[model samples]
Target: MGQPVMVKPTFEKLIPTIGSSFRCFDRTGLNLPSRWHRHPEIELTYVDRGTGTRLVGDNIDSYRDHDLVLIGSDLPHTWQSDQYLGRKYDRHSAIVIQFHPDFLGEQFFELPEFEAISMMLTSARRGLWFPAEVGEQIGAVMTRMTIEPPVLRLIHLLEVLSELSSCPSAEPLSSQGFAPSLTSASETRTEKVCHYISQHFRNPNLSHEELASHACMNPSAFSRFFKQSTGKTLTEYLNELRIGLACRLLMDSDMSILDVSLEAGFANVSYFNRRFRESRGMTPREYRRRYTEATETSNT
Candidate 1:
């Protein structure tokens, strides 16, 4: 074989007007994909209604009635709804604004006046929730931006970012893995495999054969497709999945190392310890000890 082909990450981009540096979209009623994707624009989104899973990076959780979130450049995320197929909720709506950091100029953010805004963008890499108290104010500004002229909208955008940066309490969402890496579109064979792995990650015996069968592909074909699409071997992806859950357990529960390893899909403690160390740079016990100490320090 003449060298295996290498695939790069998929990037979705925003299209701005010929002279404009930003784009805005407001949807009164819509259904967004649960598929994970990333683009290189800083995004600010306000969800007026809808409920279901909200994924940012590797953080998996539920979102409800109304949410105002800011996602940094290229941080993967999605708002998977609970709606029936092809159905749209009357009250389900959203406003999204996407822009590049250098929209004004390459050095705009380096100016003294733009320091706070730059910092806010940096913090948003971990994702952000514009604390409820200040959300309405920011949402109102975001709305005004959609109808304003490009010049005025830029001003409104600055006003919104400034307010968010100075809020008495700025809250960060998502975990340390802020880069968008995992993804699958709904009903695709890749999606089927993702669903399968998610449900069966607690079993250490997961193999390429079983995954291929579940996705209706032969082993060789599945391996080729998976690597080409995701740019990672199946085993590497599964190991990351297990380690992610293992981190949660280490932080939130009192489970022993062996138990946590088993629950996260390691067949035995030795393998778990080795993989955990490879991923986290620390053994399970040390990881747990550091996390607990940090929690205790914060509480006290």
Candidate 2:
């Protein structure tokens, strides 16, 4: 699991209360805002084509074509398109289904037939992902469910849900410990701070004063506000951003450890090694070697 980040998600209702039944959307290569957000409805999504980062309540990972995910209500999520932040023609189109937990009324869970689905929904509180084989088996039915005639569509949906409830290849994405809430003014401000850091962490000029200026607060006040909101000092957060980048480099590239350290904004190799060990419990070299070996084995 990726390190859990409990930031507030942008709050909004996914579907307008028009029809009594749930809604399905078949969008083809349309650009959607990747800003983090949440709603009260549970969501099931299948990406037929795309490549990008998907942030689902701390389960940060890259997503490619055929990615299928089911997120419980109020869990924050957004998929950033690798094509371009706003470009629609390159990649990313999906079949999405969204509904309130009580779309069939609260009494639906009382049925004996729905017992397994009830447990599955409960497990989705942490977010669930069906495997590729499950996706292949069910993806077509899901896409068609959105546009099929009402009565038949509902039956297909039930069938899909039953399949999901028992699919052995399923797994949870985000950690159970990640319980985020609605967005607030304070949270919005911190999000801006985080955005600023993510964009400029490599700059040597990045400091508490620089960050405070972006936040429109004086140095001392911003320090306290940031610590309170994120539970980490600005310095620690900066290091986290740098370390995360370093980890990505270690996994994907052939850069030397010293070069990776400098590229990740550390002044020297020794300090980077110390911090890497403290955060990762191993030196950068070992991390790269182990990760590479594991990846090679998996691919073979």
Candidate 3:
């Protein structure tokens, strides 16, 4: 969702330093790397600063400062910064930690002392997201690990994991029915179609015929292939992307509802309102109000 880029998720190979079984990176740049990639290692990522779209497995959403998420082994993911937001900082900041599931030892997490964390790892197979406040609380520890000695970093890593494992409010990002297709490499045609959709979804005149032509398939065949590869119909996928963008606009700007609807590619205001309520369980105004109130309270 970040770039007009879509492809079979490339497998990334990571090598840990000589003394550590895990790797940590504290990165700052104009934007985070927006690769649709996967790896054998599980990942914990905290966005110390930035606003952007987050794609994990089959889930897509907007993320803001203090964002935190855990990606299970081999889950495809990337974060793309919105060029329009937070330009004053001229940089995006994040800390990433990656480790094998058995980084500690084959049976380390199997012990009673790690019962909760073990359960958490299992749940992270679908991707786990913690509240922004959780990120704020643990960000300093993660930041320190960037420069701490190996043994000290390992201690802090466990402390961070222990705290996260005890958080009851962490939410799963991907749906229960969603599954990553490691075999996606063989689906180049589907990837091309997806890439095109990502770029043109905001075009109100976008049509199935046009997309099918881009994929060089009949509309009927394209529909079947897209559904099989992504577990979502074209309309369903487009709506989700638009809704995500709408939510971001609601939170980041004072755009009127009609303006937000049009900017997000909806042709009609009524339809946008209906779909927004269905997805958010509230009107756009309500969603904006709630987010604003929560942000103000946090600031206070």
TM-score for all predictions?
0.59, 0.69, 0.87
What is residue 246's positional error in candidate 2, in angstroms?
7.3
lDDT of 2 by residue, 134-187 (tens): 776677888888767777877887888888998877889776676543457765
Which digits, one per residue and each the tens of the lDDT, describe model 3 over residues 109-133? 9999999999999999889999988
Regarding lDDT, does 1 or 3 come out ahead?
3
TM match of model 1 to true structure = 0.59
Local accuracy by lDDT, each model: 0.71, 0.73, 0.82
Ranking by lDDT: 3, 2, 1
Which candidate do you rate higher for TM-score, 1 or 2?
2
* Candidate 3's TM-score: 0.87
Writing each residue's lDDT as its tens digit, candidate 1 over 41-88 gives 999888765654455655554454557788988776666554422444
Best by lDDT: 3
**Which residue pairs overlap in candidate 2's backbone?**
none
- Model 3: runs farther than 4 Å from truth? 1-9, 29-33, 85-90, 187-195, 293-300
**Ranking of predictions according to TM-score:** 3, 2, 1
Alpha-carbon RMSD of each model: 9.5, 6.1, 3.1
